[model samples]
Target: MKKLQLIGLILVLAISYQCKDAKKETQETMSDEVEATEVIVEEVVDVEIITFKMEPKSESMVQGEVTFTESDGMVSMSAVLSGLTEGEHAIHIHEKADCSSDDGKSTGGHWNPTHEPHGKWGAVEGYHKGDIGNFTADEEGNAVVEFETDQWCLGCDDENKNIVGKAVIVHQGVDDFTSQPSGAAGPRVSCTGIIN
Candidate 1:
């Protein structure tokens, strides 16, 4: 009778140990699957990228690369330029994508699809959709520009505010913002077409 009782106790202990091991294995597998799913989700987020290469007007080494990324309802722009005079410089989206001219005038005027007068960005009234303000160049002749806004879209989905097929112009002077027409931003130093 004592032997029988001992045998029953051993059997119970073995079953409990096996169940614990099985539960632990199942939990580890689930943890690994969750981690893999998180990685996959991170890899699948949608982001549209557009790039532009700016060519100097003439006798200027002012070259740059601008990248635009669209996510959600806003577009983010980043530009890295070199060989610029130290000070503020104006940047804007021009009416046409034509940058073939040596002086960059071939790109046409500032993009004013909304017919809004030239003014500071985020103003209560009178502001061109292309009025992107200015960027300051360091003493080393390098400039970095970055901003995010929902005022512009990648395509011409809303009226003509789209910038995909337009030209981005880098001016030699600062955009005074309050100046009539185009903020008197001066001549275009570099121009590039925005493309996907």
Candidate 2:
């Protein structure tokens, strides 16, 4: 009887130890799963977008819409325009967001926060921050201009990179890329104020 009782006690202890070990393993697994869930939640990012309309300037019938999208430290601009002459034209970001004047000169000169000279967008010699070059209008007088850059921002703290208080100007002629000040891109045909 004593031997039987001793054997039974040993069996109970062994079973209890295994149950405790199993519970500990389950708790550890639960902790690891929680950490993985937290890591996944931290990887999300935010995107910002702004859209505005472009009006005719300098007695031209040109009109359009401009959109700016910011994502992962990069800004993209898309402009859809109509009522243009069927040929190449110049587009740029001017210093001020004001478009009150009939000639679009109220927006001031090209956006040159860095005081760089006029040239191509990525010219080795020099280039203004607003030197966006040129795009062609289709036979139907409709054009879609798309540009992307990490050098510009929307409603950001950096004054040199922020584009909120600026203007989009579509010129009637092509950008020579060698002219000083404003690239001699001809009359501003379309204008839009980029307000925050």
Q: Best-fitting candidate, measured by lDDT?
A: 2
1-196, model 1: which lDDT tens digit per residue?
A: 9999999999999999999999999999999999999988776576678888889995577899999888777889899999899999999988888999999988888889888888888888788777788999999989999988987788747856578778888999999888888899887888898864
Task: List pairs with backbone clashes in candidate 1.
Answer: none
Q: What residue runs in model 2 are displaced by over 4 Å at the alpha carbon?
A: 1-45
Worst 10 residues of 1 by lDDT: 155-164
Model 1 regions more than 4 Å off = 1-44
Against the unseen true structure, what C-alpha lDDT does each candidate score?
Answer: 0.87, 0.95
Q: If candidate 2 were superposed on the true structure by all CA atoms, what would the RMSD be? A: 5.0
TM-score of each: 0.83, 0.79
Residue-pair clashes per prediction, in order, are 0, 0
